[model samples]
Target: MNTPKENTYTCLIVEDEPISQEILEVYIQDCPQLLLKGVCNDAIEANTILLNQKIDLLFLDINMPKLNGIEWLKSLDEVPEVIFTTAYPEYAVEGFDLNALDYLLKPFSFNRFLKAVNKFTGLQKNLAISDLSSDLTITVKSNKKTYLMKTSELNFIESDGDYLKLYRDEDCIVIHETLKAFQSKLPQNNFLRVHRSFIINLKKIDYLEGNQVCIANQMIPVAVSYREGLKELL
Candidate 1:
C-alpha cells in the first residue's frame, strides 16, 4: 500500500455562492494533503487573510461582489498559487495568462478538482528536483577568458540590459548573458531571482528591511511579483 500523505498545504476558498462554497469545501475536506484554512465571500476578507497568513493554494472565483477575483489578483503584491473557479468560459484565457494553476468551470467534478491539485503538486516536485544538483564549481565562458568559480563564492547577479553582472565577494564579472538564461544555470536552493534585474544567494541575506533584501552592504529591491516566493525562504 502507498504511504499516507501528510496535510502539508494550507488552502483558501474564495467563493461567494453558498452552494459552490459548500461543494468546494467538501472536495477540499476529502483530500488528505490539503488543509482548508478559510472561506472568503469577497476579496477584501481574503486579502486580510493573505497578509496575516501564508496560503499555499487559492481557489478563487471570477465573479464576486465589491471586488472581483481578477482585480484582486492584480492588487496583490504577493499571491499564492491560484486555481480559478468560474461559471463563464470566456475568462479562461485571461486566467491562464496570469499563470493560474487551473481554471475550473462551474459544477466541476471532484475528479477535476483533484486533477488541478495534482498539477500544483507536480510543479512543486519539479522545483524540488531542480535543487538536486550537487555540483560545487561553476564554469562560465566570458569573452575570451573562461571563468571557473566556486558556487559558494558568488554573492548575487544583476542584469544590465543585454549583459549580466556576476558578483563575487572579491570581484564582479560583466558577462554577455541575460538574467533569465543565466538564472537557469544557477542552483535553485542557493540562488533566487528576487527581481527582474536581480538574483541573490539566499545564504547571503544580511537583513530584510521592508521590501529590500540586504546582502553584504548592498540593498536589493524585491519586486511585488517575486516577494512571496522569497518569503518561503525567509
Candidate 2:
C-alpha cells in the first residue's frame, strides 16, 4: 500500500461569496494534507490571517471588494503557493503571471479539484521521498471495500471517467481513481503510462502491432508521442 503523507500544508481561503467560501472549505478539508487555517470574505480579512498564522498555501479568489486577488497577490513580498479559484477565465493569464500553482475556473467538479491537489501533493512527495515513498502494494477501494494488489502482478490499467479498470491475470478490479493519480503511485521503473488514459506493465506485453501492444488477448494503443520513448525503454 502507498504510504500516507504527513507533511500537512496550512491553507487559507480568501473569497467573498459565502457559498464559494463553504465549497472551498469542504474541498480543502477533503485533502488529508490540507488544514484549513481560516476563510476570509475579503482580502482585508485574509491579511489578518496571514499575519497571525503561517500559511503554506492560499486559495485566493479573483473578484472581491476594495482589493482584487491580482492586486493583493502583487502586494505581497513573500507569497505562498497560490491556487486561484475564480469564476472568470480572463484572470487566468494574470494569475499565472504571478506564478500561481493552478487556476481553477468556477463550477469545477470534485474530481477536477482532486486533480489539482494531486499536483500539489506530487510536488511535496518529490521534496520528501523518504517519508512519502510507497510499498509495491497498491490499495484501491470499491463499494466501501479496500483491496491491496502487488504492483508486480500481471496487468494493465485503463481510464474510465472518474475511475480506472485494473486488469490482472484473471480478474479485473474497478476502482474509483483517475488514471493520472493511479499512475503517480506505481513504480516508475516497472509501469509505463503509455497514454493519457492508460498505463501498462512492460513485462506483460506480448508483442507490438503497429502502435498497439498486445497483452493477454488485449490490445492497448500507444500514442505517437509516447512510442519513441517506449521503444527506447524496451
Candidate 3:
C-alpha cells in the first residue's frame, strides 16, 4: 500500500482485468495529488472496502463479475466522486446520468487520465463555494472572548510565531493558533495557503502580481512552492 501525502485525496480502483488494473495503478501512482487506497477485482470487493474505509475518488470499471459497476454504484446510498472506466462507449450516457466525474474509454493515454483527475480537482475546489450559505460563519476564540466571524467577511490570515492574525476589511483579530490548524476551519474551496506564513481568501483578492498578493490593501508574499496551486485557483 502506498502512503498518502499531506493534502492528498484517497482513491480506489475497481477493475476486474489485470491489464486495466495495472494501467490505472501506474497512472494513480504518478499523480501526487492522489493516493491509491485499494484495488478491487469486482464491485463486491470494492463495497467491502467502501464500508470499512473512506474513499474520496473512485475509478470504477463498468463491467465486472457478480456485480457490474453501474448497478453497484446505483445501489450505494452515499457515493464518492466517481470516474467510470470501460471499453464500451455505449455506457457513457448512463455514466454521466449518475453524475460520475468522467468516463474513460479503454486504451486511454496518461494525458487522458490526467484530464479526468484534473476534473475531479476542479470540482473539489468549487464544491464548498457552491454549497456555502450566506449566513455561514466561523466560531473563533481570542483571549477570553469568543466571536462569530462571517466567512465572507474574512480577507486573509498572517502567521506570527505561535499566533495568527485574521484580517477582515479594516478590522484584525489575533488568535492563539497555527496557520495550518486554523486552515481546517475555513472552506478549502476559497481559502488557500500561499505561503508558509500566509493563508488568503481567494474571493478577497484585490490584485495579484508575481509572488505578491494584495488583499484588503495588505501585501502577502506567495511562496514559490505554492505558486502553482494559487495559479490554478485564480
Candidate 4:
C-alpha cells in the first residue's frame, strides 16, 4: 500500500494494442505519484481528451493507425511531457529529439516502467521548485532607490565587500546586500553560487573557458569546491 503524493501527475495513455494498453494501465495504477486520466487507442481520440483536459504526462505509442505518434506529436502546438512506448528501437532517437522524458521499449519490466515514471516525478519536482521561485520577487535598495526585481530577469550577482552587484544584461546595480542574502532569494535551479564572491545565472552562461564561465562576455571564476556541482549542471 502506497500513500498518495501531495503533487500527483495526471497521465494519459495513447496506445493502439490491447495488450500494451493493459500493461500500461496496470503499471499506472501501481504508481502512487501518477493519476490515470484516460486511455485512448489512437492519436485522434487522444487529441480529443488532450483538448478537453490538462494532462501532465503522456504515454504515447509510436506505431499507431492514422497520424502515428510522431506525426501527432509534431502536429500539436503544445504538448505534455511524453514517454514513447514501442517495440521498435529505431524511433528512440526521434522520441528524444522531441524532448520525450524517456522511451519505453515494449515488453519492458515494471522496474523499467518505474524508471521512466521516476524521471517524470523528478522533472515535476524541479518544475515545482522553479514555480515557487518564479512567483517570488526580491526587494533591494540601489542608488538610494528601492527596486523590486524579478528573479527570472537577473543575469547574475557578484559580491563586492558589503555590497552586491546585480547584473541584468548591460545594466549593473549595486545593492547594499550580502551575496548570501541575495542568493537566498533567487531560484536555485536558475542561479548558483559558483564562487564565494560571485553567483552566476546558469541559464545566462554563454560558454566555459578553463575553470571560468563567460556570462554576457564577462569571465567569472569557478571555485574548486563548486566545480563538480557546476559541471553536473552544465
Candidate 5:
C-alpha cells in the first residue's frame, strides 16, 4: 500500500469565536497536511506571533474586534496565504482582494474544510511550479468516478440540498458536495456566490437581474443577503 505523503504546513488561526477556533484546531489536527503554529483571538495577538514565528498559512476572521482581517492583511509587510473564515458573506470581495486562498462561511462542514485545504495545496504547488494562471483544471470524485473539469468551462453551480449541481455550457453534473465545497475549488476572481445555494462563474454570466443571474438560458436566483457582495464581484 502506498502511504499518504506527510506534508506539513504551519498555520496560524486568528479568530475571536472560541467554538470556531476550536473547530479549526480540530480540523488542523485531523489534516495530515496542516500543523498548528499558533492561535489568537485578534489581529494584534496574531501580529505579535507573526513577528516571531514563520507561518505558512493563516485562518483569519473578517470581523475581528479592533483591526479587521483585511486591515491586518494590509498592515503586514509580508502576508502568508490566507483563508478567511467568517459568518458574514458581505466581506467576500474584500477577502478576495487580499488574495485569500479560500473563504469559508460559518457553519462549514468537514467536507467543506477539506476542499479549502485542497485549494491551498493546489495554490502552493502552482506557485512552486511558477504557474500563476488562475485558469486550470480540477479532478472531482463523484459516484466513485473521477471527472476532470476545466474551470473555464463552468457556467454556474447550484446547491440541491446537500449536493451541488455543476453546469457547463450544455452539460450539467451533479456532485456529492456542498456549495461551500465547490466555492473552495473555484478561483475567487472568476467565481462568486450570489446566493447561499448558487455560485456563478463571472465569465459565464450573460446578464444580472435585481436578484437573479442569467447564464445562457437558465436563471439563478441571488439571495438578498448576498446581493451587495455579488455587486462588488461584478
Candidate 6:
C-alpha cells in the first residue's frame, strides 16, 4: 500500500483552450499530491501569476496568440518544472529545447494523464530521498507486464505513432505510453530532449554530428530547432 506524501506541489496551467484547461483542472483535483495554483490564457497572464505566487510546476501550451510557450520560457531566468501541452507535433522538439519535464498532446486521456502524474510523483520521491547517487529504477508496463528499468540502462527513447519506444544498449521495447509520462520520471541532469520525437540519455551519447546524435550504434536525428540547445547539452 502506498501512502500519499505530505508535500503538496503547486501547479499553474497556461492554456488558451477552455476545454483543455477544464480537463487539466479536473485532473489536478483528482491528485492528492498536486494543488492547482491558477490557470491563465496566455504567457502574459501566466507571467502575472508567476510574479505573485510560488509555483512548483507549470502546465504550458505551446501555441498561443502572443508570446508562445517556448518563447515565454526562454525569457524566464528562473523557471519551475514545465510540462508542455500542444496540438501540433512539430513543436515537440522546440518544447524539449526549453527543458520541459514533459510534452502532452491535446485531447489526451485520463489514463495518459495519470501516467504523467505518476512520473511527477516518482521524481518528488527521488528528490526527497537523501541518497541522490543511488541507482534509480522505474517500471514501465507493456503487454500487461511490468518491466523494471534502470536509469543507466536507457540510451534514448523515440515516439512511434501513439506509442513510445524505449531503447537500451541492445534492446528496444515498445510501450503504449506517451513520451510525456516517461519524461517526468527521468532526472533532468542525465536525460535531455534532443529532438521533437526523441529523448537521449546525455551520458550515453558518444558524439553529435550536424543534426544527428550518436549513442552506441544508433544515430538519432536532432531537429534543427532543437540543435542549438542540444549542442549546449553536449
Best by lDDT: 3
Candidate 4: minimum summed lDDT over ten consecutive residues — where? 1-10
After aligning candidate 1 to the native by TM-score, how far in Å is the CA of 140 from where it should be? 18
Number of the top candidate by TM-score? Answer: 4
Each model's lDDT: 0.88, 0.84, 0.91, 0.90, 0.87, 0.85
TM-score for each predicted model, relative to the true structure: 0.61, 0.52, 0.58, 0.62, 0.53, 0.54
| Candidate 3 structure quality by residue, lDDT tens digits, 1-234 | 666666689999999999999999999989999999999999999999999988999999998899989999999999999999999999999999999999999999999999999999888767645767432688999989999998788888999999999898768999999888898888788789999999988988999887899987878999999999988988
RMSD of each: 10.0, 15.1, 13.9, 7.7, 15.4, 15.6
- Superposed by TM-score, candidate 6 places the C-alpha of residue 103 at a distance from the truth, in angstroms, of 0.9
Q: Taking the tens digit of each residue's C-alpha lDDT, what string does model 4 give over 92-201?
A: 99999999999999899999999999998999889888777665687889878998877777778889999998999858989888888878888787889999999988
Candidate 2 residue-wise lDDT, 1-234, digit = tens: 133346877788899989888888788768888888788888989888787778888889989998998999898877988889999999999899998889999988788888888788777678677334433777888878898888877479999898888999978988888787888888787688888888999878999999999988999999999999889889
Candidate 1 per-residue lDDT, tens place, 1-234, comes to 132345467889999999999999999879878888899999999999999888889999999999989989988999899999999999999999999999999989999999999998888777666655523677787878999987677788999989988888898988998888887887777888889899998988899999999888999999999999999987
By how many angstroms RMSD does model 1 differ from the true structure? 10.0
Order the numbered candidates by TM-score, best leading.
4, 1, 3, 6, 5, 2
**How far off is residue 65 in model 1, in Å?**
0.3
Better of 4 and 5 by TM-score: 4
Name the Cα RMSD for model 4: 7.7
Off by over 4 Å in 2: 1-5, 129-234
Candidate 1 wrongly placed segments (more than 4 Å): 1-7, 132-153, 156-234
- Clashes (candidate 6): 1
List the pairs of residues colliding in candidate 2: none
